[model samples]
Target: MNIHIIWDEANLPIIKSNLSNVIDVIDDTIAVSFDTWLFSSNGEFVIEFYHDGQTIIGLK
Candidate 1:
């Protein structure tokens, strides 16, 4: 299982310490939007955070 995390640079330490299953950690510097519907029916585990807004997605 590979986990893709979209987050800010400031949270790097937190991500490194807490998440051991993360495969890719993408900084949110790029101008992109993630539509919930796009991942809603994928049957994968998706976590959306409001504060700091870190998106964690699991892909097979």
Candidate 2:
């Protein structure tokens, strides 16, 4: 499994402290959108987000 995180740099401490429960941190933030991407053996996956948003995630 792969885990991805996109959040404000200022929250590094909080995020680091909760690595085991990172999803909770993202859930607590006020973000524009949250999404996921899945790829097949021959396919490519990508994650896109607006920089102005509070948090972004591309869980694959």
Candidate 3:
């Protein structure tokens, strides 16, 4: 699945370097072909969640 990440352009490079193993980075956000997962570091285990048809999944 193709994944498009949303982040500040300034942080793009750093985020890309870390997530390269899992996703394909693109310059803009558009309709992606596959499921999208967002990962964010929160001073603990990184959180991962998928976007369902309505809202974000895996919220705790």
Over the stretch 1-60, how does candidate 2's per-residue lDDT look in tens digits? 233444345434322223335346544542523432222223233234444543333344
Superpose all Cα atoms of candidate 1 onto the true structure and report the RMSD in Å to 1 decimal.
10.1
Model 1 worst lDDT window (10 residues): 29-38
Sum up the clashes in candidate 3. 0
Model 3, range 1-60, lDDT digits (tens) per residue? 222344333434333234454535431221342333344443222323333433353433
Ranked by TM-score from best down, the candidates are 3, 1, 2
* TM-score pick, better of 1 and 2: 1
Candidate 1 residues lying further than 4 Å off, grouped into runs, are 8-43, 52-60
Q: Write the per-residue lDDT of candidate 1 for residues 1-60, one digit (tens) a residue.
A: 333444444433222222332323333322233322112233365555434455444553
Off by over 4 Å in 3: 1-30, 43-52
Over 4 Å off, model 2 = 13-46, 51-60
| TM agreement with the true structure for every prediction | 0.26, 0.24, 0.27
Task: Tell me the lDDT of candidate 2.
Answer: 0.36
Q: How many backbone clashes are present in model 2?
A: 0
